[model samples]
Target chain A: MTPATPRRRGRPSRTESADTPAARDRILAAAREEFSERGYDKTSVRGIAKAAGVDSALVHHYFGTKEQVFEAAITLSFAPAMEAPRTVEEGPLDGVGERLTRFIFGVWENPATRKPLLAIVRSAVNNEAAAAVFRRIIVTQVLRRIADRLDVPDAELRAELAAAQLVGIAMLRYVIKVEPLASADPEQIIKRVAPVVQAHLTGPGL
Target chain B: MTPATPRRRGRPSRTESADTPAARDRILAAAREEFSERGYDKTSVRGIAKAAGVDSALVHHYFGTKEQVFEAAITLSFAPAMEAPRTVEEGPLDGVGERLTRFIFGVWENPATRKPLLAIVRSAVNNEAAAAVFRRIIVTQVLRRIADRLDVPDAELRAELAAAQLVGIAMLRYVIKVEPLASADPEQIIKRVAPVVQAHLTGPGL
Candidate 1:
């Protein structure tokens, strides 16, 4: 919830905002709240600024648009998988699928980041703008990068497929909280899913 | 869309529901609109009744509960794919992935069903009751059947993993409209994704 012990003050004061990172964090926090409440279409820089107790200009100064703010807010907490492409690039490739599955499920299981991530997913389902920001992150940051690392045809497609499977499970397990997926043992999921991920990553052609 | 020429009456006559089918259609249509617009948690039986111009008691008579109404509303549109588990059981197993992808995506790409299906996915993302209904249909109606037909170890888990991938694709491609995926050609998707599905269905144990 709170980003950290406020470096500058308990609240995001104007002076605190001038410190760049603190201001950005406050703006991001504001963006998350606004986006969660109003979604991407309704949330605006001005509103986020008002919530963060910063000038509208400062919200823009920290993040370019509502889209950018959303991207930053959601993906900031996705730091765990930011480098997931490397899991493919450097690994023996056989276990990349497991790593990918484990990495994503691990993120969802985590308490610190899962709340914001859930908000992002929940909003994205209903709003096109939110979907766009979410899509950009999944493709550009995660899928495309991993696909590019592979030496296969339809690499990108495979990667997207793998990502889609994980996202669906996440939808049921976390966002929707569907059972037995909602309550299934994590190892049960990992054992079943990882091999499929491996197939998408390094398996033969269609 | 309108489901064929209504044999009964243009409007739901109070007595028409006595015939069963007409009343059920009216209730389903009302349920779809209410759930799409207000989501599962927000939608009430009274609201659906008002939308259908029927007594809330009639809605109860037809669908049992709000949860049941939500279930019927979503899965009703999924009628085409209801036979999909049989596709696995009856067909050459290797093409099951392609068949499954084609079937699910086919449901999505259809004009009549897509709109309602979209509503279900969008609403389910945030609401637990809707999610539960969705999970029930997916697990019991579809996933379990396909798994039961399979002659493999952890058949249910394997079936679910394949499904998770496909469901994830639906989340991004349909619900979130994530790009390249959102825009990519369906044939292109089926080609890349089907193999992984095949692997999950009958490939060697992990």
Candidate 2:
């Protein structure tokens, strides 16, 4: 460890070897596994650091507290799904529903992304602190982004209602693995559910 | 301990006092508290029996297994929501969506029902066995009933789609408690969300 090694001074000390991006990614990955397997209440910074083969100070250095670790891990896992709001912005307003639905499901359909997502949802469901982190991320990063782009009244409510429809489908089909819905083709679901989502986002009042 | 006390023949033996409806109810109530507090994977029949102040044998005799106990508790907790399907059968097909939506939300809006339902959802979310129990009860008891009554083509799929919408709303508003949607007035939500639910159940193809 050289005195000349770059450091973000004033933060708690960390091993220079643990400061690399690879080390950070490893810690984040380990945090996901610990949170997924043990859930939010049971997972700790020490556990994550041990799993990552790094010093405890390193986990704290990279992510702060256990809750911050949870936030960082969830933010990474939810990154793909969170990008769906961008789909809402890029497409014509009329087709945003199908585009957003397709984009969100596309993220869920892939096993790599889906596994972490499943872990995130399970943690969020089991722990209130995890749920609060999840809520803030989804609302501020995802739903609010979509709401900001919308021309409709009740835009935030509309964004959440749209989100609820998609989130529910994910719960039943993926998490709960409810039949027919679970086994049915993904495109088939997008076909049926997209318009209702569309209506919630842009259609006239009930 | 009267020899004349009625018992189901050939089952595991149990105390007569533990076999009464009050005892069974006590056990079931205890099981809910245990599962809710501990979640499905961590909760045990022994724990539930202990909480209810009864012998483990009596819990087994009455509920059979931990899964069965979960099924019974879920069935009981979901009883009110399950009854919403009957409203579908009673009303004109045109009005089924509003009636069904109102009925389902009504179950969630009340704190007494909401807490157990929240527990059931958390259990389902956390464990596949619990999810299976929830899926079966919902499909056979609730969604299937609504599907059976719907005259539409693709009835089961349609029923599930509608359920997905409401379940998503409940997951967000009640369980996840996302703001705006979480704090929105119940009737306002029903008014806005009911039509999308209706569309899923009965509206024209997209």
Minimal lDDT window, size 10, model 2 chain A: A1-10
What's the true lDDT of residue A119 in model 1? 73
What TM-score would each prediction reach against the true structure? 0.82, 0.90
Tens digits of per-residue lDDT for model 2, A23-105: 89989988887887777877789878877778889899888999899999999888898888889999799999899999988
lDDT of 2 at B183: 93
Model 1 per-residue lDDT tens digits across residues B60-121: 88789878888888887667668779778777887788888788778777877777777777
Error of 2 at B67 (Å): 0.8
DockQ of each: 0.41, 0.40
Recovery fraction of native interface contacts for candidate 1: 0.64
Model 1's alpha-carbon lDDT is 0.74
Point out the worst 10-residue segment of candidate 1 chain A by lDDT: A1-10
lDDT of 2 by residue, B65-171 (tens): 99999999888888888788888989688898889989988899999888889889988887888989999999999888888887666888888889988999998
lDDT, candidate 2, at B134: 93
